[model samples]
Target chain A: MSNILEVRGLKVMYGKSIAIHDINISVPEGGIVTLIGSNGAGKSTTLNACLGTVPATEGKILFAGEDITHASTAERVRRGLVLAPEGRHLFPYLSVQKNLLLGATQRSDKEGIQRDMEFCFELFPILKDRLKQKAGTMSGGQQQMLAIARGIMANPKLLCLDEPSLGLAPAVIDDIGNKIREINQSKGTSILLVEQNVHLAFGAASYCYTLQVGEMVAEGSVEEIRNNDVVKKAYFGG
Target chain B: MGVIPNIMVNALVLASMYILASLGFAFIFNMLGSVNLAHGAFYMLAAYITYYLCAKAGLNNWVAMLLAAIVLAAIGIVMERFVFRPFQTEFDRVVMVSVALMTMLQQLAVQVSGSQTISIPAYGNGVLDLGFMTLTNEKLITFLVGLILLIITLYIVYRTKLGMQMEAISQDRLGAALQGIQVNKVAMLVCGMGFALAAVAGAMMGAYQQVSSNMGDNINVRILMLVMLAGAGSMNGILITGFLMALLDSVCPIIWDSYTASAIACSAVVVLLLIRPKGFFGHEM
Candidate 1:
């Protein structure tokens, strides 16, 4: 009934440049919201601000009704606001198992972590086979899967993903799309996905917000956004 | 009976001390991405502190080493929080800070302890006549101490949660932060461990050799060579290279003289460095 995550008047500046201005977005409880935009859009900046990796010039970010604008990235993560990041950011030298375990670094619940790790293995059996293998040795698709599964391992209440399908085969992108839906349905986890792949985002997310430059150009249900003439021309190639 | 046995024993002792000194140096380097020049300063201070605690305060040798370790560990924590953390991102600032620390500590040792040589009282006395080869209790104890500490250090780095976190931080700081790891907290622990290892090595070496103001100078250069040969951010690399250096240090002096040994070792390092800049066990620089 209530929004699980909210960002209001989120303004981010980079030296002399205004990266994002007055960006307002929200993810309702158990809702899957997708933010779609082009290269120079402020999608990544929004995610980074929410994670507190980049300091916000002006804004308020709310997680479960609590303002976490000033919290550190670790603090934000501890409170179940996790980001998988754009590049997958795997510790390449470390084994796959170590990377997965690091996902729950702040959590002390041993039993819960054990259960979640098992769940991750079940979700990505490829990962189970490559426990000792270095993550860097994996293919692009496998690495992306690991990054997403790593986010799940954190047991996040609101998982903010930045470009889950940036550089992957079409089949792998489809698998990721299905997995996102499956995660949303099964785990009831609220997700804020940022994507350049409009089809994958539209297929997975029930709600959609279109970002152009630094501002939200459109926001509505997936069907409503699909039918919009401006969005169709800009994103869907009408 | 022969210098061969003594040489072998000396190599092991030297390897252990070098390993101990470099282990902390490697940890700090991995965590901070800086070449901790003040590590030698910390090592020198620990030797001096242990000297005062044992020789001046009339404490037992083992007790003095333990006290010195705790004190140095505390100092390391303070340095990490106040000194290293502030200039963590700025390489130039860290260098300035570290150079200031090294110069100050080196001077402090010269002024307080003077240039005079003072040896720690032996933990035990007399030689163990083990049939063929005789052994001094001082060398035997120092070797044992070094071996045990090396094992402990290996255990802490290779088989612990803290170690995993350390590796994670070294490889990817942002990724570790995203996982809710308290990076600063982990850095403090590592900084303390680094200080503790250096302190222990300083104490053991001071007991074996005589403590002088310039004791840290040779060791400082030795550690630099060890770390460089090991490459950046490679723990196992340091271990292998440390053994190789100890071998050179021990056998060369026996074959020629100490100065000749130093010259040979330096030459070998320079040649190998040009061939493989990243060191033996390291990845791309």
Candidate 2:
């Protein structure tokens, strides 16, 4: 499949410190591409740069064959590059329904939003039950579910998830993996997932990129990555 | 005037006025995460602007009040884009910027209107002798304006889409940006609303009490204290705390000297904060 999103030589900096350096990544039109790395591996920064939250100090980001390197975060989102950020960043004070509704902020299609809300309800039935409850009051697993569901509500062409299974039980992590597959297979949406859980990442993605210390060290299918000794030792614990 | 009736009227009037000013200050502080010392300047500047339009430019007091609100709101948009936006992340710089704004506006007010206290001739100078109490039209008008404005503020914050976005942004800037909320535009809108509220409060209170350049300086402290007591991200808390503080401001002077009354109020606030730590509705912004 043709690439829906591509980052070429992208470098991101935080003051004097560089977070991601000369990173090249892409999400094909219908594939799950996972960036598996440990904490402080510049994984989240790569996602932020693609979403335009962090400015790319160098190189270009092409979305759907259009140059979108210097776009505003909102513009990037509107153009369907949505990120369900790390930390499950829900508006803690707002009700769950409000949080879910806010996910479709850039869209004015009332019927479409309603349909998507129903879609979220179907995906996370707990969200429907806790519509009036504050988002922060929910359990961690449920909040992660809500975050992924909220990201889906944006009608994203490419959904980027940062640390989706960061602090969840094994069963919940399995559930997240299942949902990632469902999103890919059902919606035909390209995904760029950042994860510290190498096992979950390898299971969910067709292709994986191993990032270590602000650099892409490996890129291959799960079987191919298993054969790369350095990547296997560093990420797969081989 | 019956002593109790007079005090009650004073309390209500003062509470209403203080709420108008403090609500604006609190929202700006929460949304922008800035102390916004310049908020008081907007209040003082609005009074002078209205006063100028009425007294010098030959406009009706009511018309001038509307004009002042619009002008101040427009100025607020410019300020948010330039003065406040640059310092969004740096709290120290925001404080410094606001201080500079306050100084310049206060000087302008003093230069234009002098050191003496000024007043807008009451909205309709008449008293309603309701047997138990004497109430002037100015007192009633100020209270009504305050009440109506408070309602509008509540409605905007609770009912509108933009208000929802503001709350989201105030809660988590990164999360809101991820949701494509266009945070800068919302921040600018909030600043406009804040300046407009300050203008209305200043114009009304100028008629009620006095309009001096230095008037804003003292009231600014009162507004800040009210906000701190209310805590961040708690707009309703601001309204409640504002009323409580206004009652203290009005009632304490009757029982003791003004400074002693203020001391008691401050001490009580300190105790309450010690007990709860996060004000009444303390939530993170």
> C-alpha displacement of A206 in model 2, angstroms?
0.7
lDDT of each: 0.88, 0.87
lDDT of 2 at A145: 90
Task: After superposing candidate 2 on the true structure, give the runs of residues whose Cα lies further than 4 Å from its correct spot.
Answer: A236-238, B1-5, B129-132
Model 2 chain A: lowest-lDDT 10 consecutive positions: A229-238
The prediction achieving the highest DockQ against the true structure is 2
Candidate 2 per-residue lDDT over residues B5-29, each given as its tens digit: 7877888888888888887778778
TM-score of chain B of each: 0.95, 0.94
Would you give the TM-score of chain B in model 1?
0.95
Docking class of 2: medium
Task: Give the winner by TM-score.
Answer: 2
Q: What local lDDT does model 2 show for residue B211?
A: 82
How close is chain A of candidate 1 to the true chain A, as a TM-score? Answer: 0.98
Poorest 10 consecutive residues by lDDT, candidate 1 chain B: B276-285
Q: How well is candidate 1 docked (DockQ)?
A: 0.62
